[model samples]
Target: MDGGERYQEFDPPKALRPWVRKVWTYACPSPSRTIQRIAPDGCPELILDLGDPYEEADADGVFHLQPPALFAGQMTRPIAIRPVGPVELVALRFHPDGARDWLGRSLRTATDQRLNMTDRLRDLSPPAGDPEAQARQMIDWMAGQRRDDWSIDPLVRTEVEAIHADQPSPPRDASARRALQRRFLDRVGIAPRTLRSVIRFRRVFDHAMAEEAEGWLSAGLDAGYFDQPQLAREFRRFLGCTATEWAREQVELARAIASQSYKPGGPEPG
Candidate 1:
């Protein structure tokens, strides 16, 4: 990774805060071709590539060039990405419920998929100026796209809040649980349990990175994992590698981007 690479996140406008989490930018003035593994963070994003496009690996491990603009849905697993050249892009990270409202459809159709947005987000042009300006422009566009009727489901909001707070979900009978699962599938593209697992893994990862815990064992335990073995299992499940191996990878750019999700008041990692 280039040492000069830059990444920053900006708060969205008040009107759009319910749906848009934040506007972020990444730029590398000097290019150094390096692949980065991105872990799933349970949020969807709209990316506007202002410079060279990236190459993303599919499940088969074939790297395909991405479009200049695209919508990335809820990711269930890690993905590998490499910049083809100098990287410059602005992205909108959306809340799970927000994405459902913005897309006007069930998120299940978008889960684990990346769709070209050039056609769907018609007439949207890459914003000019610096990162802050670009972020502001993106926020403006998102504000314009809002629908008066768009609102988050109360149950989904409550459940998401409980997860983030590390509190148990309100007790529900089997039938109610099934109903909530269906709603989660539509609005978040994953079940409540799955979201909890991902969020827990993310917390462990973040704590490890910040050295907030003494070691992986402590990190996992603090994040509520039952034991070291369970922690290792989650590491492999979310990152396709042991925590030690992932640390050895030393993909600085990817690490920096991931760290942004943990910023104060930032929505659950995306």
Candidate 2:
């Protein structure tokens, strides 16, 4: 990471709030070429690489260069990325149930995959400028892409809200649970239980980063884990590492970016 590196998130415009979570930018005038591990958070992303393209390692540890524009679908595991040069990119993070509308496809088709969107990039090309200006351009393009009849499944939205709020999910019989799972696969790209687990892991990660608790055990407990072993299992499941190991490996830029706070569907700060 360079001293010039920065990561900032901006809220989506009011009309697009239901579909888009946030528009964000990451830039580094001179990157240090460190591999950063990005853990899953249950949201799909549209990433436009405005600067040098990044190298993403596959499951077999083979590094493949990414396209200038791509759609990253719901990831069940962590991915490692290394900057090939100076880095700058604008990203649109869609809510779990929101992407299927903009993408015009089943979310399940894109799960754990980064699909090339270079052809679609022509319409989204940003003029040379600062990241904020580029981000505005991207957001404006997304606004144009919005359809009048676009809408998310009401049941999916309700379940997503429950997960984020850390509230007990509504009681469901086996048949209801199966029905919800089908809807979630089509709209959210993951099972309902998987989403819940990911959100819970996010709380633990945030707590650890904030140092709000004495240790990982306390943080996990605060995040609703039954015991240390359960927390450790989640850590390995989401991050592919223990809690302490993940913290130890976080680069300065990753740490700083992860520490920022924002509530979903809230008003964007000026």
TM-scores for all candidates?
0.91, 0.91
Local distance difference test, each candidate: 0.78, 0.80
Model 1 C-alpha lDDT per residue in residues 121-226, reported as the tens digit of each score:
6666665448888887788888888889988888987888788778899889999999999999999988888888888888778654543235767867987989
Model 2 — which ten-residue stretch has the worst lDDT?
261-270
Q: Residue 171, candidate 2: how far off, in angstroms?
A: 1.9
Please state the error at residue 22 of candidate 2 in Å: 0.6
Model 2: residues >4 Å from true position, as ranges?
Answer: 210-213, 261-270
Model 1 pairs in collision: none
- Candidate 1: which stretches are off by over 4 Å? 1-3, 127-129, 208-214, 262-270
Residue-level lDDT tens digits of model 2 in 226-247: 9988887887887787766667
